[model samples]
Target: MAADAAPRSLSGKVLDVLDAFSADAPELTLSDISRRTGLSLSTTHRIVRELSEWGALERQGRGPYRIGLRLFEVASLAPRGPQLREVALPYLEDLYEATHENVQLAVREGLELVFLERITGRDAVRVLTRVGGRFSLHATGVGLALLAFAPPEVQEQVLSGSLERWTERTITDQGQLRRMLADVRRTGVAISDRQVTMDALSVAAPVVGPDDCVVAALSLVVHADGASPHTLAPAVRTAARGISRALGSPTARRHPAGARRRASGP
Candidate 1:
Protein backbone atom coordinates (compact mmCIF):
# COMPACT_ATOMS: atom_id res chain seq x y z
CA MET A 1 0.00 0.00 0.00
CA ALA A 2 1.10 3.60 -0.64
CA ALA A 3 2.15 5.70 2.33
CA ASP A 4 -0.34 8.15 3.81
CA ALA A 5 0.09 11.79 2.74
CA ALA A 6 1.24 14.44 5.17
CA PRO A 7 -1.54 16.55 6.63
CA ARG A 8 -1.69 20.21 5.68
CA SER A 9 -0.86 22.81 8.33
CA LEU A 10 -3.24 25.57 9.45
CA SER A 11 -1.24 28.16 7.45
CA GLY A 12 -1.40 25.98 4.34
CA LYS A 13 -5.18 25.64 4.76
CA VAL A 14 -5.46 29.42 5.11
CA LEU A 15 -3.40 29.90 1.95
CA ASP A 16 -5.69 27.46 0.15
CA VAL A 17 -8.67 29.61 1.11
CA LEU A 18 -7.00 32.80 -0.15
CA ASP A 19 -5.86 31.08 -3.37
CA ALA A 20 -9.51 30.22 -4.09
CA PHE A 21 -10.12 33.84 -5.02
CA SER A 22 -8.89 34.88 -8.49
CA ALA A 23 -9.63 37.35 -11.29
CA ASP A 24 -12.33 35.08 -12.73
CA ALA A 25 -13.89 34.30 -9.34
CA PRO A 26 -13.51 37.40 -7.24
CA GLU A 27 -16.38 36.64 -4.96
CA LEU A 28 -17.48 33.37 -3.34
CA THR A 29 -19.89 32.11 -0.74
CA LEU A 30 -18.95 29.97 2.25
CA SER A 31 -20.07 26.83 0.51
CA ASP A 32 -18.26 27.86 -2.68
CA ILE A 33 -15.07 28.53 -0.75
CA SER A 34 -15.33 25.19 1.00
CA ARG A 35 -15.83 23.39 -2.31
CA ARG A 36 -13.01 25.23 -4.04
CA THR A 37 -10.57 24.77 -1.16
CA GLY A 38 -11.54 21.18 -0.41
CA LEU A 39 -12.12 22.20 3.22
CA SER A 40 -14.95 21.11 5.47
CA LEU A 41 -17.81 23.62 5.76
CA SER A 42 -17.16 24.13 9.48
CA THR A 43 -13.45 24.80 8.88
CA THR A 44 -14.21 27.11 5.99
CA HIS A 45 -16.71 29.04 8.07
CA ARG A 46 -14.29 29.42 10.97
CA ILE A 47 -11.46 30.58 8.73
CA VAL A 48 -13.67 32.91 6.74
CA ARG A 49 -14.98 34.47 9.92
CA GLU A 50 -11.46 35.03 11.20
CA LEU A 51 -10.27 36.46 7.88
CA SER A 52 -13.28 38.74 7.62
CA GLU A 53 -12.75 39.98 11.14
CA TRP A 54 -9.11 40.67 10.29
CA GLY A 55 -10.19 42.56 7.14
CA ALA A 56 -8.72 40.12 4.65
CA LEU A 57 -12.18 39.39 3.22
CA GLU A 58 -15.34 41.41 3.10
CA ARG A 59 -18.92 40.21 2.73
CA GLN A 60 -21.71 41.98 0.92
CA GLY A 61 -25.14 41.98 2.62
CA ARG A 62 -24.95 38.34 3.69
CA GLY A 63 -24.02 37.39 0.16
CA PRO A 64 -20.70 36.20 -1.36
CA TYR A 65 -17.44 37.59 0.03
CA ARG A 66 -14.77 39.42 -1.95
CA ILE A 67 -11.13 40.18 -1.32
CA GLY A 68 -10.72 43.10 1.06
CA LEU A 69 -8.83 46.37 0.76
CA ARG A 70 -6.61 45.11 3.58
CA LEU A 71 -4.99 42.76 1.11
CA PHE A 72 -4.14 45.63 -1.20
CA GLU A 73 -2.80 47.55 1.76
CA VAL A 74 -0.43 44.72 2.58
CA ALA A 75 0.53 44.22 -1.07
CA SER A 76 1.53 47.87 -1.31
CA LEU A 77 4.43 47.19 1.02
CA ALA A 78 6.05 44.89 -1.51
CA PRO A 79 9.18 46.56 -2.89
CA ARG A 80 8.82 45.10 -6.36
CA GLY A 81 5.13 45.87 -6.87
CA PRO A 82 4.02 49.29 -5.62
CA GLN A 83 7.51 50.63 -5.10
CA LEU A 84 8.63 49.78 -8.62
CA ARG A 85 5.48 51.33 -10.06
CA GLU A 86 6.02 54.46 -8.00
CA VAL A 87 9.51 54.84 -9.42
CA ALA A 88 8.52 54.21 -13.02
CA LEU A 89 5.27 56.15 -13.20
CA PRO A 90 6.84 59.43 -14.32
CA TYR A 91 8.62 57.88 -17.27
CA LEU A 92 5.51 55.87 -18.11
CA GLU A 93 3.46 59.07 -18.08
CA ASP A 94 5.92 60.72 -20.43
CA LEU A 95 5.59 57.79 -22.82
CA TYR A 96 1.81 58.03 -22.59
CA GLU A 97 1.92 61.77 -23.29
CA ALA A 98 4.03 61.13 -26.38
CA THR A 99 2.02 58.31 -27.96
CA HIS A 100 -1.35 58.27 -26.19
CA GLU A 101 -1.24 54.47 -26.46
CA ASN A 102 -1.70 51.62 -23.99
CA VAL A 103 1.33 51.70 -21.69
CA GLN A 104 2.08 48.67 -19.52
CA LEU A 105 4.63 47.63 -16.88
CA ALA A 106 5.20 44.00 -15.96
CA VAL A 107 7.57 41.75 -14.04
CA ARG A 108 8.33 38.08 -14.52
CA GLU A 109 7.09 35.78 -11.78
CA GLY A 110 8.50 32.31 -12.38
CA LEU A 111 7.18 31.19 -15.78
CA GLU A 112 4.47 33.85 -15.80
CA LEU A 113 4.46 37.65 -16.01
CA VAL A 114 2.35 39.86 -13.75
CA PHE A 115 1.24 43.33 -14.82
CA LEU A 116 2.10 45.98 -12.22
CA GLU A 117 0.33 48.83 -14.04
CA ARG A 118 -1.36 49.92 -17.26
CA ILE A 119 -2.12 53.38 -18.63
CA THR A 120 -4.52 53.66 -21.53
CA GLY A 121 -6.23 56.57 -23.22
CA ARG A 122 -9.96 56.50 -23.90
CA ASP A 123 -9.29 56.19 -27.63
CA ALA A 124 -6.42 53.71 -27.36
CA VAL A 125 -6.86 50.30 -28.92
CA ARG A 126 -8.52 48.03 -26.39
CA VAL A 127 -6.20 45.56 -24.66
CA LEU A 128 -7.08 42.41 -22.71
CA THR A 129 -4.68 42.94 -19.81
CA ARG A 130 -5.49 44.28 -16.34
CA VAL A 131 -3.20 45.52 -13.59
CA GLY A 132 -2.22 42.66 -11.23
CA GLY A 133 -3.30 40.04 -13.77
CA ARG A 134 -0.90 37.21 -14.64
CA PHE A 135 -0.11 35.98 -18.15
CA SER A 136 2.22 33.44 -19.70
CA LEU A 137 5.77 34.58 -20.49
CA HIS A 138 5.71 33.75 -24.19
CA ALA A 139 2.84 35.78 -25.65
CA THR A 140 2.93 39.52 -24.83
CA GLY A 141 5.67 42.03 -25.71
CA VAL A 142 6.32 42.83 -22.03
CA GLY A 143 6.43 39.12 -21.32
CA LEU A 144 8.98 38.59 -24.10
CA ALA A 145 11.17 41.45 -22.84
CA LEU A 146 11.18 40.00 -19.33
CA LEU A 147 11.81 36.49 -20.66
CA ALA A 148 14.74 37.60 -22.80
CA PHE A 149 16.74 38.82 -19.80
CA ALA A 150 15.68 36.03 -17.44
CA PRO A 151 18.27 33.65 -16.01
CA PRO A 152 19.48 30.90 -18.36
CA GLU A 153 17.78 28.18 -16.33
CA VAL A 154 14.55 30.14 -16.35
CA GLN A 155 14.89 30.62 -20.10
CA GLU A 156 15.50 26.90 -20.56
CA GLN A 157 12.40 26.03 -18.55
CA VAL A 158 10.19 28.31 -20.66
CA LEU A 159 11.73 27.18 -23.92
CA SER A 160 11.30 23.52 -22.96
CA GLY A 161 7.74 23.89 -21.79
CA SER A 162 4.56 24.15 -23.81
CA LEU A 163 3.76 27.67 -25.05
CA GLU A 164 0.15 28.85 -24.90
CA ARG A 165 -1.44 30.46 -27.95
CA TRP A 166 -3.66 33.47 -27.35
CA THR A 167 -4.24 34.14 -31.06
CA GLU A 168 -3.26 32.82 -34.49
CA ARG A 169 -0.11 34.93 -34.43
CA THR A 170 1.18 33.64 -31.07
CA ILE A 171 4.53 31.85 -31.39
CA THR A 172 4.32 28.25 -30.14
CA ASP A 173 7.27 26.40 -31.62
CA GLN A 174 10.21 26.17 -29.20
CA GLY A 175 12.86 26.90 -31.85
CA GLN A 176 11.00 29.96 -33.09
CA LEU A 177 10.53 31.28 -29.56
CA ARG A 178 14.21 30.74 -28.82
CA ARG A 179 15.12 32.72 -31.91
CA MET A 180 12.67 35.46 -30.98
CA LEU A 181 14.11 35.77 -27.48
CA ALA A 182 17.58 36.01 -28.97
CA ASP A 183 16.45 38.80 -31.24
CA VAL A 184 14.93 40.67 -28.31
CA ARG A 185 18.26 40.52 -26.48
CA ARG A 186 20.25 41.59 -29.52
CA THR A 187 17.99 44.49 -30.44
CA GLY A 188 17.06 45.53 -26.87
CA VAL A 189 13.44 45.48 -27.89
CA ALA A 190 10.52 43.05 -28.19
CA ILE A 191 7.56 43.25 -30.55
CA SER A 192 4.30 41.36 -30.26
CA ASP A 193 2.31 41.96 -33.45
CA ARG A 194 -1.20 40.63 -33.00
CA GLN A 195 0.13 37.92 -30.74
CA VAL A 196 -2.41 38.46 -27.98
CA THR A 197 -5.21 39.83 -30.15
CA MET A 198 -5.75 40.17 -33.88
CA ASP A 199 -6.11 43.95 -33.69
CA ALA A 200 -3.28 44.92 -31.29
CA LEU A 201 0.51 45.10 -31.40
CA SER A 202 3.08 46.05 -28.74
CA VAL A 203 6.71 47.20 -28.61
CA ALA A 204 8.60 46.63 -25.33
CA ALA A 205 11.96 47.24 -23.66
CA PRO A 206 13.58 45.97 -20.46
CA VAL A 207 13.81 48.05 -17.26
CA VAL A 208 16.69 47.19 -14.98
CA GLY A 209 17.18 47.74 -11.28
CA PRO A 210 20.20 48.92 -9.25
CA ASP A 211 21.71 45.48 -9.61
CA ASP A 212 21.96 46.03 -13.36
CA CYS A 213 19.53 43.15 -13.84
CA VAL A 214 16.15 43.46 -15.50
CA VAL A 215 13.40 43.97 -12.94
CA ALA A 216 10.49 44.84 -15.23
CA ALA A 217 9.40 45.46 -18.81
CA LEU A 218 7.72 48.53 -20.32
CA SER A 219 5.57 48.40 -23.44
CA LEU A 220 3.18 50.33 -25.62
CA VAL A 221 0.28 48.46 -27.17
CA VAL A 222 -1.42 50.07 -30.15
CA HIS A 223 -3.87 49.23 -32.92
CA ALA A 224 -2.26 46.82 -35.35
CA ASP A 225 -3.66 48.43 -38.51
CA GLY A 226 -1.06 51.18 -38.67
CA ALA A 227 1.33 50.07 -35.92
CA SER A 228 5.04 50.11 -36.65
CA PRO A 229 7.17 48.48 -33.92
CA HIS A 230 10.30 50.07 -35.44
CA THR A 231 8.76 53.51 -35.31
CA LEU A 232 7.99 53.03 -31.60
CA ALA A 233 11.25 51.32 -30.61
CA PRO A 234 13.30 54.46 -30.02
CA ALA A 235 10.80 56.06 -27.66
CA VAL A 236 10.13 52.82 -25.80
CA ARG A 237 13.84 52.11 -25.34
CA THR A 238 14.53 55.66 -24.21
CA ALA A 239 11.78 55.55 -21.62
CA ALA A 240 12.96 52.15 -20.41
CA ARG A 241 16.48 53.50 -20.07
CA GLY A 242 15.16 56.48 -18.15
CA ILE A 243 13.25 54.19 -15.79
CA SER A 244 16.37 52.06 -15.29
CA ARG A 245 18.39 55.16 -14.48
CA ALA A 246 15.80 56.34 -12.00
CA LEU A 247 15.98 52.91 -10.40
CA GLY A 248 19.77 53.41 -10.09
CA SER A 249 20.83 50.74 -12.54
CA PRO A 250 24.61 50.94 -12.99
CA THR A 251 24.44 50.06 -16.66
CA ALA A 252 21.96 52.86 -17.35
CA ARG A 253 23.93 55.33 -15.22
CA ARG A 254 27.23 54.73 -16.97
CA HIS A 255 26.34 55.78 -20.51
CA PRO A 256 29.07 57.73 -22.33
CA ALA A 257 28.70 61.57 -21.96
CA GLY A 258 27.01 62.46 -25.26
CA ALA A 259 24.94 59.25 -25.40
CA ARG A 260 22.29 60.78 -23.14
CA ARG A 261 21.72 63.75 -25.48
CA ARG A 262 21.40 61.41 -28.50
CA ALA A 263 19.07 59.08 -26.54
CA SER A 264 16.79 61.99 -25.65
CA GLY A 265 15.46 62.20 -29.28
CA PRO A 266 16.48 62.93 -32.89
Candidate 2:
Protein backbone atom coordinates (compact mmCIF):
# COMPACT_ATOMS: atom_id res chain seq x y z
CA MET A 1 0.00 0.00 0.00
CA ALA A 2 2.84 2.39 0.86
CA ALA A 3 4.54 1.59 -2.45
CA ASP A 4 1.33 2.19 -4.38
CA ALA A 5 0.87 5.55 -2.66
CA ALA A 6 4.15 6.86 -4.00
CA PRO A 7 4.80 8.08 -7.54
CA ARG A 8 7.79 6.43 -9.23
CA SER A 9 9.31 9.76 -10.27
CA LEU A 10 8.87 13.52 -10.06
CA SER A 11 7.48 13.54 -13.60
CA GLY A 12 4.86 10.93 -12.71
CA LYS A 13 3.68 13.01 -9.75
CA VAL A 14 3.29 16.09 -11.91
CA LEU A 15 1.38 14.14 -14.56
CA ASP A 16 -0.90 12.51 -11.99
CA VAL A 17 -1.77 15.88 -10.49
CA LEU A 18 -2.45 17.41 -13.88
CA ASP A 19 -4.75 14.52 -14.83
CA ALA A 20 -6.92 15.06 -11.73
CA PHE A 21 -9.04 17.65 -13.56
CA SER A 22 -11.58 16.38 -16.06
CA ALA A 23 -14.58 17.50 -18.13
CA ASP A 24 -16.94 16.28 -15.43
CA ALA A 25 -14.91 17.77 -12.59
CA PRO A 26 -13.19 20.77 -14.12
CA GLU A 27 -12.71 22.53 -10.82
CA LEU A 28 -11.38 20.61 -7.83
CA THR A 29 -10.34 21.41 -4.30
CA LEU A 30 -6.90 20.63 -2.88
CA SER A 31 -8.34 17.65 -1.03
CA ASP A 32 -10.04 16.51 -4.22
CA ILE A 33 -6.73 16.71 -6.04
CA SER A 34 -5.04 14.76 -3.26
CA ARG A 35 -7.62 11.97 -3.48
CA ARG A 36 -7.58 11.94 -7.30
CA THR A 37 -3.79 11.74 -7.50
CA GLY A 38 -3.44 9.39 -4.49
CA LEU A 39 -0.92 11.74 -3.02
CA SER A 40 -0.60 13.29 0.46
CA LEU A 41 -2.19 16.73 0.93
CA SER A 42 1.16 18.41 1.47
CA THR A 43 2.57 16.85 -1.69
CA THR A 44 -0.54 17.67 -3.69
CA HIS A 45 -0.54 21.25 -2.44
CA ARG A 46 3.12 21.72 -3.20
CA ILE A 47 2.79 20.53 -6.80
CA VAL A 48 -0.52 22.33 -7.27
CA ARG A 49 1.15 25.58 -6.23
CA GLU A 50 4.03 24.96 -8.61
CA LEU A 51 1.66 24.10 -11.47
CA SER A 52 -0.50 27.14 -10.71
CA GLU A 53 2.56 29.34 -10.74
CA TRP A 54 3.50 27.93 -14.16
CA GLY A 55 -0.08 28.64 -15.45
CA ALA A 56 -1.02 24.95 -15.91
CA LEU A 57 -3.71 25.26 -13.23
CA GLU A 58 -5.67 28.26 -11.99
CA ARG A 59 -7.15 29.26 -8.65
CA GLN A 60 -9.09 32.44 -7.98
CA GLY A 61 -10.12 34.07 -4.69
CA ARG A 62 -10.27 30.79 -2.77
CA GLY A 63 -12.19 29.19 -5.65
CA PRO A 64 -11.79 25.58 -6.78
CA TYR A 65 -8.84 24.90 -9.09
CA ARG A 66 -9.34 24.56 -12.85
CA ILE A 67 -7.14 24.00 -15.88
CA GLY A 68 -5.53 27.25 -17.11
CA LEU A 69 -5.30 28.97 -20.47
CA ARG A 70 -1.60 28.22 -20.79
CA LEU A 71 -2.36 24.56 -21.44
CA PHE A 72 -4.81 25.55 -24.19
CA GLU A 73 -2.18 27.82 -25.68
CA VAL A 74 0.23 24.88 -25.82
CA ALA A 75 -2.41 22.37 -26.95
CA SER A 76 -3.45 24.60 -29.84
CA LEU A 77 -0.22 23.73 -31.58
CA ALA A 78 -1.31 20.10 -32.02
CA PRO A 79 -1.92 19.68 -35.75
CA ARG A 80 -4.94 17.39 -35.79
CA GLY A 81 -6.49 18.51 -32.53
CA PRO A 82 -7.97 22.03 -32.32
CA GLN A 83 -6.60 22.81 -35.77
CA LEU A 84 -9.05 20.28 -37.18
CA ARG A 85 -11.84 22.03 -35.28
CA GLU A 86 -11.11 25.31 -37.07
CA VAL A 87 -11.53 23.58 -40.44
CA ALA A 88 -14.72 21.78 -39.41
CA LEU A 89 -16.42 24.74 -37.72
CA PRO A 90 -17.81 26.29 -40.91
CA TYR A 91 -19.30 23.00 -42.11
CA LEU A 92 -20.74 22.42 -38.65
CA GLU A 93 -22.29 25.89 -38.82
CA ASP A 94 -23.86 25.06 -42.18
CA LEU A 95 -25.27 21.77 -40.90
CA TYR A 96 -26.75 23.47 -37.84
CA GLU A 97 -28.34 26.26 -39.93
CA ALA A 98 -29.90 23.72 -42.26
CA THR A 99 -31.35 21.36 -39.64
CA HIS A 100 -31.47 23.37 -36.43
CA GLU A 101 -30.62 20.12 -34.66
CA ASN A 102 -27.67 19.00 -32.54
CA VAL A 103 -24.64 18.62 -34.78
CA GLN A 104 -21.42 16.96 -33.53
CA LEU A 105 -17.91 16.06 -34.66
CA ALA A 106 -15.76 13.40 -33.00
CA VAL A 107 -12.58 11.44 -33.41
CA ARG A 108 -11.70 7.94 -32.21
CA GLU A 109 -9.01 7.58 -29.55
CA GLY A 110 -8.47 3.90 -28.81
CA LEU A 111 -11.94 2.47 -28.08
CA GLU A 112 -13.22 5.81 -26.81
CA LEU A 113 -14.93 8.55 -28.80
CA VAL A 114 -13.73 12.06 -28.02
CA PHE A 115 -16.11 14.87 -28.95
CA LEU A 116 -14.35 17.69 -30.83
CA GLU A 117 -17.24 20.01 -31.64
CA ARG A 118 -20.98 20.28 -31.07
CA ILE A 119 -23.73 22.72 -32.20
CA THR A 120 -27.13 22.50 -30.62
CA GLY A 121 -30.47 24.21 -31.22
CA ARG A 122 -32.92 25.33 -28.59
CA ASP A 123 -35.06 22.25 -29.07
CA ALA A 124 -32.38 19.67 -29.66
CA VAL A 125 -32.95 16.55 -27.64
CA ARG A 126 -31.20 16.65 -24.29
CA VAL A 127 -27.77 14.97 -24.32
CA LEU A 128 -25.16 14.21 -21.72
CA THR A 129 -22.33 14.79 -24.19
CA ARG A 130 -20.05 17.80 -23.86
CA VAL A 131 -17.10 18.93 -25.95
CA GLY A 132 -13.83 17.20 -24.91
CA GLY A 133 -15.81 14.42 -23.25
CA ARG A 134 -15.28 10.72 -23.91
CA PHE A 135 -17.74 7.86 -24.45
CA SER A 136 -17.59 4.23 -25.49
CA LEU A 137 -17.42 3.30 -29.19
CA HIS A 138 -20.56 1.13 -29.18
CA ALA A 139 -23.22 3.61 -28.06
CA THR A 140 -23.11 6.67 -30.33
CA GLY A 141 -23.45 7.45 -34.05
CA VAL A 142 -19.95 8.89 -34.34
CA GLY A 143 -18.68 5.92 -32.37
CA LEU A 144 -20.17 3.40 -34.77
CA ALA A 145 -18.96 5.33 -37.83
CA LEU A 146 -15.39 5.48 -36.55
CA LEU A 147 -15.50 1.91 -35.27
CA ALA A 148 -16.68 0.72 -38.66
CA PHE A 149 -13.57 2.09 -40.35
CA ALA A 150 -11.11 1.54 -37.51
CA PRO A 151 -8.15 -0.79 -37.94
CA PRO A 152 -9.02 -4.48 -37.73
CA GLU A 153 -6.93 -4.93 -34.58
CA VAL A 154 -8.80 -2.20 -32.79
CA GLN A 155 -12.13 -3.65 -33.92
CA GLU A 156 -11.22 -7.10 -32.74
CA GLN A 157 -9.88 -5.80 -29.43
CA VAL A 158 -13.13 -3.97 -28.67
CA LEU A 159 -15.21 -6.92 -29.79
CA SER A 160 -13.29 -9.41 -27.74
CA GLY A 161 -15.01 -8.47 -24.48
CA SER A 162 -16.04 -5.80 -21.96
CA LEU A 163 -18.58 -4.13 -24.27
CA GLU A 164 -20.35 -1.71 -21.93
CA ARG A 165 -24.11 -1.08 -21.93
CA TRP A 166 -24.94 2.60 -21.51
CA THR A 167 -28.71 2.38 -22.06
CA GLU A 168 -31.13 -0.48 -22.63
CA ARG A 169 -30.83 0.11 -26.39
CA THR A 170 -27.05 0.17 -26.34
CA ILE A 171 -25.53 -2.80 -28.22
CA THR A 172 -23.66 -5.07 -25.86
CA ASP A 173 -23.82 -8.19 -27.98
CA GLN A 174 -20.67 -8.66 -29.99
CA GLY A 175 -22.39 -10.44 -32.87
CA GLN A 176 -25.06 -7.78 -33.24
CA LEU A 177 -22.53 -4.97 -33.11
CA ARG A 178 -20.45 -6.71 -35.79
CA ARG A 179 -23.46 -6.76 -38.10
CA MET A 180 -24.24 -3.09 -37.38
CA LEU A 181 -20.67 -2.20 -38.30
CA ALA A 182 -21.06 -4.15 -41.53
CA ASP A 183 -24.21 -2.20 -42.39
CA VAL A 184 -22.38 1.07 -41.69
CA ARG A 185 -19.64 0.01 -44.09
CA ARG A 186 -22.18 -0.91 -46.76
CA THR A 187 -24.20 2.33 -46.58
CA GLY A 188 -21.51 4.92 -45.86
CA VAL A 189 -23.49 6.10 -42.84
CA ALA A 190 -24.28 5.05 -39.29
CA ILE A 191 -27.56 5.43 -37.38
CA SER A 192 -27.76 5.30 -33.59
CA ASP A 193 -31.39 5.04 -32.49
CA ARG A 194 -31.86 5.55 -28.79
CA GLN A 195 -28.44 4.04 -28.29
CA VAL A 196 -27.13 6.86 -26.14
CA THR A 197 -30.46 8.15 -24.85
CA MET A 198 -33.99 6.88 -25.40
CA ASP A 199 -35.29 10.31 -26.44
CA ALA A 200 -32.67 11.01 -29.12
CA LEU A 201 -31.50 9.50 -32.40
CA SER A 202 -28.21 10.20 -34.21
CA VAL A 203 -27.06 9.85 -37.81
CA ALA A 204 -23.35 9.95 -38.66
CA ALA A 205 -20.93 9.65 -41.57
CA PRO A 206 -17.16 9.51 -41.76
CA VAL A 207 -14.76 12.23 -42.86
CA VAL A 208 -11.77 10.73 -44.64
CA GLY A 209 -8.39 12.34 -45.22
CA PRO A 210 -6.30 12.71 -48.38
CA ASP A 211 -4.80 9.29 -47.73
CA ASP A 212 -8.26 7.69 -48.05
CA CYS A 213 -8.30 6.98 -44.32
CA VAL A 214 -11.15 8.02 -42.08
CA VAL A 215 -10.00 10.77 -39.72
CA ALA A 216 -13.18 11.80 -38.01
CA ALA A 217 -17.01 11.64 -38.03
CA LEU A 218 -19.93 14.11 -38.10
CA SER A 219 -23.49 13.58 -36.89
CA LEU A 220 -26.88 15.16 -36.22
CA VAL A 221 -29.00 14.44 -33.16
CA VAL A 222 -32.76 14.97 -33.19
CA HIS A 223 -35.85 13.97 -31.24
CA ALA A 224 -36.60 10.30 -31.68
CA ASP A 225 -40.37 10.77 -32.12
CA GLY A 226 -41.34 10.87 -35.80
CA ALA A 227 -37.63 11.03 -36.71
CA SER A 228 -36.23 9.40 -39.86
CA PRO A 229 -32.62 8.17 -39.89
CA HIS A 230 -32.56 7.95 -43.67
CA THR A 231 -33.98 11.44 -43.92
CA LEU A 232 -31.21 12.83 -41.74
CA ALA A 233 -28.35 10.76 -43.19
CA PRO A 234 -27.86 12.82 -46.34
CA ALA A 235 -27.40 16.11 -44.54
CA VAL A 236 -25.10 14.61 -41.96
CA ARG A 237 -23.07 12.97 -44.69
CA THR A 238 -22.96 16.21 -46.65
CA ALA A 239 -21.53 18.00 -43.66
CA ALA A 240 -18.94 15.28 -43.13
CA ARG A 241 -17.89 15.57 -46.77
CA GLY A 242 -17.68 19.33 -46.54
CA ILE A 243 -15.45 19.17 -43.47
CA SER A 244 -13.25 16.63 -45.23
CA ARG A 245 -12.89 19.00 -48.18
CA ALA A 246 -11.97 21.87 -45.89
CA LEU A 247 -9.26 19.62 -44.44
CA GLY A 248 -7.87 19.12 -47.95
CA SER A 249 -9.02 15.56 -48.55
CA PRO A 250 -8.64 14.81 -52.27
CA THR A 251 -11.53 12.34 -52.32
CA ALA A 252 -13.96 14.74 -50.68
CA ARG A 253 -14.92 16.48 -53.92
CA ARG A 254 -14.41 13.36 -56.02
CA HIS A 255 -16.50 11.00 -53.88
CA PRO A 256 -19.03 9.24 -56.13
CA ALA A 257 -22.67 8.70 -55.32
CA GLY A 258 -22.79 5.78 -52.89
CA ALA A 259 -19.04 5.50 -53.13
CA ARG A 260 -17.68 1.99 -52.53
CA ARG A 261 -14.58 3.21 -50.73
CA ARG A 262 -14.25 2.52 -47.04
CA ALA A 263 -15.07 6.13 -46.24
CA SER A 264 -17.67 6.86 -48.96
CA GLY A 265 -19.25 9.67 -46.90
CA PRO A 266 -21.77 11.89 -48.72
Please state the error at residue 94 of candidate 1 in Å. 0.8
Supply the TM-score for candidate 2.
0.91
Which residue runs does candidate 2 get wrong by more than 4 Å? 1-7, 256-266
Can you give the TM-score per candidate against the true fold?
0.93, 0.91
Highest TM-score: which candidate? Answer: 1
Per residue, candidate 1 scores C-alpha lDDT tens digits across 1-266 of 00133677788888888999999999999998998888888989999999999899998799899999899999998888999999999999999999999999999999999999999989999998999999999989999999999999999999889888889999999999999999999999999999999999999999989999999999999999988889999999988998999999987887622266468455
Error of 1 at 168 (Å): 2.2
Taking all chains together, the TM-score of candidate 1 against the true structure is 0.93
lDDT of each: 0.91, 0.88
